[model samples]
Target: MHFDLADLRLFVHIAESPSLTQGARRAHLSAAAASARIKALESQLDSRLLYRDNRGVELTPSGQRLLQHARLILRQVERLKDDFSEQGGDQAGHIRIFANTTAVTEFLPEVLAGFLAARPAVTVDLQERLNRDIVRAILDGSADLGIVAGPVRAEGLEILHFSTDHLVLAVPPGHALERLGRPPTLADTLGYFHVGLHEGSTLQSFLREQVERLGGTLNLRIQVASFEAACRMIEAGVGIGVLPETAARRHQRSMGLSILQLDEPWVVRERSVLVREREALPGCARTLVELLRQVGDGVVAP
Candidate 1:
């Protein structure tokens, strides 16, 4: 019924690695010590927490729930320590952020570079995630902040306008799609082969969802990791691609790519920043949020 931070930390490592030996090594304990700890945890909780197999270990449902709580607890403890350290003039902190693909690849890099440059003792852990997932992570205390596009469903989290962007079709100049004499809709372009973003990209997932809603599939000829790569492929006439207008415009002239506006309502995207509570955030995290707002407002060029 009672366990310490060490127990929670050890459990998290084991669940993440799914290897007793590796988890033990990470916790600076031997395999036997780690195994004993796990057994003690299971007995204390009165639940089976893992499933063992030749491959590795898998968390049981109970273990999955525990993992979530453990992460949240550890994060809160870190935040407390960071607050105390900063107040003591050490100014050391770590901020975790979850953002969608556009924010990750297009928006945050320049802003983060400036933020990190001024605060050498501050570190950021930025990750790309789906919009909804980003919102959930913020609510769960797993992420200090989030940048997401489209509508946000987070009820209690603070949402600030981040930026506005639109998805556009990028094709080779004089391509068949460009010759349509009008802006082509996503449905119209589905028939053509397309260069797409990587499978895990939020933008790529959004495109697929839209395609499915229209009862069609994206005819992707190849998948690349970035908007630039997609534009390069489109310029080579490999296939057409959907890209954020901001990114597409940057490469349009150099790549000889034609940008076609999509005739769908969802094409227009609004990005927002989500925070649990502004006043409750660590000092460094609050500063970063302010910087993000400035960039979003065009006070600072990104």
Candidate 2:
């Protein structure tokens, strides 16, 4: 039998609350209107739906069965409306994104600006977290896309390499490492006290792996959770650190710190763009990914 979604909505609301008065309150209808809708639905189905008693309302056997179907039908109807709205081809829906600290602060500004300029109707929401957290957002469908560092592994997700950012050595102006004319090897650099961020960061992981590959380990003097804290310690001559070039440039002059390009063997970290499905990406999300590719084209050589 065919029934209107409005009828099903009223039924579910009544079934959930089991009290016509409360259901009407929840659905923003008067008692008479709610009872009328429920009676109409019961007539259309040719069955007794509810039994009235001192406990307010109780469902008949048929009513209990129809309640489940009503909930499913209402959910599908809502999904259909959302799908059609998003397919309106107006580029005027919400898009959520996840990104790491470096990308959020240093990389996405220009790309996001260009996107907002072109698609004025679209609204962008962004959050900053570590690479793993960003990946989790995409997998759980909480974010439409994610920008992160290397080593993302998930089924049905396509990872695209967009840029490669080197980890530069930053030292206080008067620090021993700053007195050297040329950059030192990972081994030689570790001979001095080292300041670094805590271990969970992708950048920190990358540095540790590279150092281990060269048969050495960092003598970390202090490990803080934030890059700003690490930079502060480095500026105070507590030790040297390997930080992103983008971040280093932002605070180097003001913080009285100097950044030196490490030797060729120590170049670390490559930034990547990730999407759940490249071919089926939403229109606005696809556009943003393309813009990032264009901007970082020369930054990462293939």
lDDT scores of the candidates, listed in order: 0.86, 0.75
List, residue by residue over 1-302, the lDDT tens digit for candidate 2: 67887778777778768598998888889999999988888888899999987688988999877876675465445434444764454355556788876777676876778678777777888877678777866664556688887566766678888778877888888766665677766777878888887766667776788888888888999998767788889889899988888788777757978888888554766778877666455556676777788778853321
| Deviation in Å, model 1, residue 176 alpha carbon | 2.6
RMSD of each: 2.4, 10.4
Report backbone clashes per prediction: 0, 0
The TM-score that candidate 1 achieves is 0.89
Worst 10-residue lDDT window, candidate 1: 83-92
lDDT string for model 1 (1-302, tens) is 68789989998888868587888888999989988889989999999998877788899999988888887788768768876783432256788899988888987998889787878888898999988889888886778899988887899899988678899989898888777888899999988999999988899999999999999989999999888888999999999988999999998868889888988999988888899887767778888888888887788875
Give the winner by TM-score: 1
- Highest lDDT model number: 1
- In model 1, the Cα lDDT at residue 103 comes to 87
Those runs of model 2 whose alpha carbons end farther than 4 Å from true positions after fitting are 1-90, 117-121, 132-140, 151-156, 179-182, 209-229, 264-268, 298-302
TM-score of 2: 0.60
As for candidate 1, its clashing pairs are none
* Alpha-carbon runs more than 4 Å astray in model 1: 86-90
